[model samples]
Target: MRPLTDQEMKVVLDKLANYMSDLKSLIAPLEDGDRYVFRLNHNRVYYVKLSLANLATCVGRDALLSLGTCLGKMTKSGKFRLHITALPILARGARHKIWVKENGAQPFLYGSNIVKAHVGRWSEDCPEHQGCVVYSMADIPLGFGVTARSTTEARRLDPTGIVCFRQADCGEYLRDEDTLFAG
Candidate 1:
């Protein structure tokens, strides 16, 4: 319902940059027509078009449950947490990715961390602790998580070793139904 402050914008961009190598490339398409803009409402950040945002101004903040795509939410401690709703945008330009095997897909969707045995493949040169998107063998994005080891290090990890730490998963949309869309 309001524009993001300069500092807040920086934080959001920084968090996004963790998934994509180029920040401008990630944002260029959204701003292509100059019709889209980012807005903040009740700690949640939305990517909405200018025209819709203009119209939304006429509505009271309390009544505006949501607008556009919910990219993520700003936490109480000032950290930005990317939401599962942002999977499409993040997957498009993801710098590093981990593809889970068919048998592992169910567990990952259920919020379990990806184990080394379940890793079907991963981006080359992926570094330790880097943010990466998780996908199924069929190329469907299941979630996003942080790497537990570097590419080389993972090569020597045991089958039971944790490969990716779950951050957010698509299943949250159903599991968190009550609060996800609540204003």
Candidate 2:
């Protein structure tokens, strides 16, 4: 394909530059021609998929952010049909867990023989509220959108992604792993 015209390129670059910080709106309407460059967990540069329309395009620096941040954003309500392509990590040997709290009336499901569900102070004590449908380690997989349960008493939310990396270089996600999330 012919290169983008000078004017076309400028317009594209400007959109990219403008959508720098927390550009949620821009991302929401991104089209086939739109582009983005975001970082993996360890600040590793990676191109994002831009199939907003029919023709595919490339997103170079100035789009993506750390994986931790991205997953956190998705945890919110009304997430769009997002597409992501990146290196997949090896599954953790231990159990996978995620902690969640509904923003409104508590969410529940009917089990074979249960009528009770978690109510007030939901997620306050994971062990408690046995009736509610809170997140569990066994149901989760290693990837984005997995919110980390607070490791501390504060119970604050930390959106984290499990990327495979050595001790010295964590969060550096790879495009394709000969080894893992990063080279």
Candidate 3:
């Protein structure tokens, strides 16, 4: 990954602005601390690690590691895209949530798409391709997904098939996590 160009930075800033209104202010500090870009190919930044002065600025804080991290990708046309991680979603600031039961949540964390049958309830306004926080029945955030279909279409689809595409989940980063089940 590479540090985004000024134009690319503006695109990322606009996308994240919805969730983090103060994202631009963090850029200077991020540059000063430690800046490294993990890229998928040669142009897109997939993960970014940066520092922050206060824990309130981000989800995790450790003296040995940088905080205020984000996961993103570059579009085929070279536009930067950002997605929220499970850690930050747990902070309770996420706007869209797709609620699932234990059975569904388990598979989802293992990187399975949310089948229509397993979807219990969801934020009605969640649009396709937008990031949505996945919540367990108990209201704990399980991970994040990009909506594959609109609310109305999802409700109309066959219940046994996939609905939302999984992005990242708690299991991949947490232990006791059995690998994704073949079933």
Candidate 4:
């Protein structure tokens, strides 16, 4: 594993900023005392402590399956794709969020797009095509997706109109059990 290059860091930060407005606030907690660091292994970005990362260097690359929290992976085309596993971290700093109604929770968990009627509440400033975290009425993080319409536009949409397009949902853990963490 190796530290992310300047270019890689920029790509990762830009992608993360899509979900959260302040990149510094999102990354501040992870850099406390330089105790933690981000590393790249198998193209996957991991948030690991410095000591553990040092120890991991002794192990062969192929033998090391994982380390710390798997933030996501860098694609061949140089794009950073956020993974479902990073939900908790992202949710903590989410600028815009959508709260799904009880009846809509199940369908969202099933990987369906959120519809206008299913929205319990949402950040009023959420813009169309912007990334936002999805939550249950109880405030549980369910997933993240891009808004299909702005709050103003959605207010006039029919109940069946799509509000947010599903990108990745928590249900993938169960639906893709075998391959979820495969190398």
Candidate 5:
């Protein structure tokens, strides 16, 4: 509701840094470009190992779309599990002020009220908070940046490369199709 002050920004940034480190560690065992599928409880979790360069590409492509791209980037194996890399992290980068606005990023820049490298999405409706979360170009570090905002305005805001979804009670996304979904 109110502007994010300098102190608030730092806290979120701290969270993002720890998150990225944990994420990097998680994927460290997997070879670069390798994808993994894990079944957590009855739900499925997909992961892919990727570098910063590949992450940049995803940001460029998914930045302008109205609905954040879904599991289009997931690599499929067997029948249930899908493999995906740090698309969510890339997505947070794409929206970072540091990445600079690429093609089709204007509209998204205007509406969002928040953007931070450490804020990750807990629900399907995440990102595109416009200048509210906009971080300085120098604030981003070379790792995964989590992005988030209130669920109420998610559909209306359009930060570039944001992911949008409505989750079911079972923790499974009803449907997802990001540009990166396995080809």
Candidate 6:
């Protein structure tokens, strides 16, 4: 893993900015930090660790700061897909956040979706299949999810059903298993 070049930075930021709003504001400060690339089998993963604790505090003001990798992605096919990491979320915050109740936090941290009943708050205008940030009631981001139904349809459905499809979660990053490096 190594630092990204100017061209590489532009490519990544461009793709990420398209999906994440206010990305420019969040990533601008991070540009000065070191970015490392990890080639895992067929995927190219990139990550940037903020240089200081105050950087995260300035962004999200969260506690328990450590050697966490925020603002990371794995290249799929020829493009990059966002990996929900702590630092970036704390730094820039997601444009759309789906807040789930306490009962749902465990499931969500394990990559489960927010059922209609568990969903406490969601971006009202987020459409189906759009990527969104999933958070706990305390405002700590759990991971990423793709909206499964339109807001109107979701609201009309029963509370027991799933509202979004979980894509990634915090546990993946926190796990100590060798799966991440497995071939």
Candidate whose TM-score is highest: 1
lDDT (Cα, tens digit) per residue for candidate 2, span 1-183: 123345544443333332122334334545665654332322232334343211322433343222321211111232211112221211122122233323211121111111122111323333321112223233322222211232232234223321111111112233223423222
Error of 6 at 101 (Å): 0.4
lDDT on C-alpha atoms for all candidate structures: 0.90, 0.26, 0.60, 0.89, 0.30, 0.62
Candidate 3's residue-wise lDDT over 23-97, tens digit each? 434434453566534323233343444332232335332322322344555577867644334246223566577
Off by over 4 Å in 1: 29-32
Clashing pairs counted in every model = 0, 8, 1, 0, 30, 0
Q: What is the Å distance of residue 131 in model 6 from its true position?
A: 1.1
TM-score per prediction, in order, is: 0.94, 0.17, 0.59, 0.93, 0.19, 0.67
Which segments of candidate 5 are over 4 A away from where they belong? 1-15, 18-22, 26-104, 107-148, 156-183
Candidate 4 local lDDT, 126-169, one digit each (tens): 78999999999999999999999999999999999999999889
Q: Model 1 RMSD to the real structure?
A: 1.7
Error of 4 at 157 (Å): 0.5
Q: Rank the candidates by lDDT, best first.
A: 1, 4, 6, 3, 5, 2
lDDT of 4 at 114: 100
TM-score of 6: 0.67
What clash pairs does model 3 have? 1-39
- Order candidates by TM-score, high to low: 1, 4, 6, 3, 5, 2
- Per-residue lDDT of 104 in model 5: 18
**Clash tally for model 4:** 0
Kindly report which residue pairs in candidate 2 clash with one another: 36-59, 37-64, 38-64, 42-171, 96-137, 97-137, 118-132, 174-181
Q: Which scores greater on TM-score, model 1 or model 2?
A: 1
Error of 5 at 131 (Å): 12
List model 5 lDDT by residue over 7-118, tens digit each.
Answer: 4334433433422333344334555555432211112222222342234334433342312122221113322222123334433423332232232123223333223222
